[model samples]
Target: MAPPVSESPPVETLDLWLLEAAMELPTPLHMLVEPNPHIALNMADDPRLSREELCERLSLLAERGLIRVHALPDGLQELFSPEEISSAIDARQSRTPFGYSLTDAGGAIWEHHARPDWSRFVNAGQEPSADEAQDAWVIEAASLEAADAEFHFHESLGDVHQPVGESKHGEVLTPWQVTYWKTLPHGYRLRYVTVPRPADPARSRSVPSRPPWYTRVWL
Candidate 1:
């Protein structure tokens, strides 16, 4: 049997940020399908909502303040039992989960965190790419020397990297990291690796370009 799902940590901000500007969605179906159980659903997993329909509904949601736009990293976003969510909310390097209510604020953020640009949430605090990361290198994998003299690789998840991949045992690699290891000059020690990134598009010093006539600058 699969292990239980873990919950997400709570976010503190609660402004009425529009879903559309956050992450694109079609409709605003804020009603919880399973309130007592408080299960989260994503039609993206369902086949009934055609691509067009899905887009329509997601778009609608985005247009309203019912949701927030956030992007999921390569390895994140899964159901967590109330207990797991509870735990995360209880402890964090930063904020904590308020409660199970999915406060109008939390729900609103969760739904639209994907709006303006679905990548926002997923990329939060994401290290600048290697080049951008400067020395920013999200750990792709880590390992401990095995008893049998084999290298044990532990993929990073929110460790050296945010939303880093889960470990071989399928647990978050939050604080645990690869401390010591042996590798050949050409042979990598871990199963995976992350290279530096180019740069942050948001801060790139690109040359200014003329805006279309429709856009005007006060200056």
Candidate 2:
């Protein structure tokens, strides 16, 4: 007989964009006090995600208290913007009426965490501003060389094994350094440029075409 199925491990990461929307409510605070559809419409902009996926995220956000939800009531459409009210009206037709609004804790989290981290994930391939450059730390290249001693590359996987966004060469940053990097302003993505090999390839520290040690980070 086949072995019984093991339970899945607990999820450690939430959807980053979903979390961002929950924390940043574009509309007025008063409208939020009473649940309305305005916030979800504003927050969920990813065309790739279907409305069902967006609803699932909304439910998750509600459970976390980043947003509050309420059952739809008659004539409550007055509270929402034209777009929100229209969506709510359509939802009513399907008997799946619900609304959500950001909570105080959500706003606090936006101010402290999400807003600061927003720049890191969004803007790639641009140079960092002067203020952002100050936040970077220059780590010795030797440490990364040691880390890359066990490096293996699988060309077939393409970007699957690669970092989600731009990365600082073969060496990964320490967790605190990563957090600091996230707090930097937008347009600054960390990546390593390939340094040309010297006349004596044997003396070069960088690996052939795939250098594990990054000499510098282009902010």
Best candidate, lDDT-wise? Answer: 2
Write candidate 1's Cα lDDT for 1-219 as tens digits. Answer: 112221234222322222221222221232211232112332222223333443344333323423322222111332233333333333323332121122234343544333322111111122454454333322222222221121122122222322222321222334332211111121112222243334444433342432221111111
lDDT of 1 at 30: 28
Clashing residue pairs found in predicted model 2: none
Off by over 4 Å in 1: 1-48, 68-106, 109-135, 138-219
- For each candidate, the alpha-carbon lDDT, in order, equals 0.27, 0.34
lDDT of 1 at 161: 28
Report the poorest 10 consecutive residues by lDDT, candidate 2: 210-219
RMSD of each: 18.6, 16.6
Each prediction's number of clashing residue pairs: 47, 0
TM-score of 2: 0.27
